[model samples]
Target: MAGLAIPTWDPETALLIGTILLEAIVLYVGYGGLERIVGPRLLKLVVGGE
Candidate 1:
């Protein structure tokens, strides 16, 4: 099962993983920023103020 075996030193695999990780981090930071900007107002509206 050559295809099933993972390479011990694979640059392509590393790059692919890195890309996915970077995207996840970017998304996380963006969502955190959005929450910081909108969360308080949304919470207040939902809970009927203060």
Candidate 2:
């Protein structure tokens, strides 16, 4: 029977995982910034208020 093996460091896998993590952080920050910039304007337009 084969036993479970421990995880090893793989450059390709590390890079892919890092890329995904970086992208998530970037998207989160970008969306937050965009919301801060556009949210109030959008709310005013939707509510028809100045």
Q: For each candidate in the order shown, give its overall lDDT on alpha carbons.
A: 0.94, 0.97
The deviation in Å at residue 44 for candidate 1 is 1.2
Estimate the TM-score of every prediction: 0.73, 0.82
Q: Best candidate per lDDT, number?
A: 2
Error of 2 at 1 (Å): 10
* CA shift of 13, model 2, Å: 0.1
- List model 2 lDDT by residue over 1-50, tens digit each: 46788889899999999999999999999999999999999999999998
Scored against the true structure, residue 22 in model 1 reaches a CA lDDT of 100
> In model 2, how large is the Cα lDDT of residue 8?
96
Candidate 1 error regions (>4 Å): 1-7
lDDT by residue for model 1 over 1-50, one digit each (tens)? 46897569689989999999999999999999999999999999999877
- Residue 32 CA error for candidate 2 (Å)? 0.2
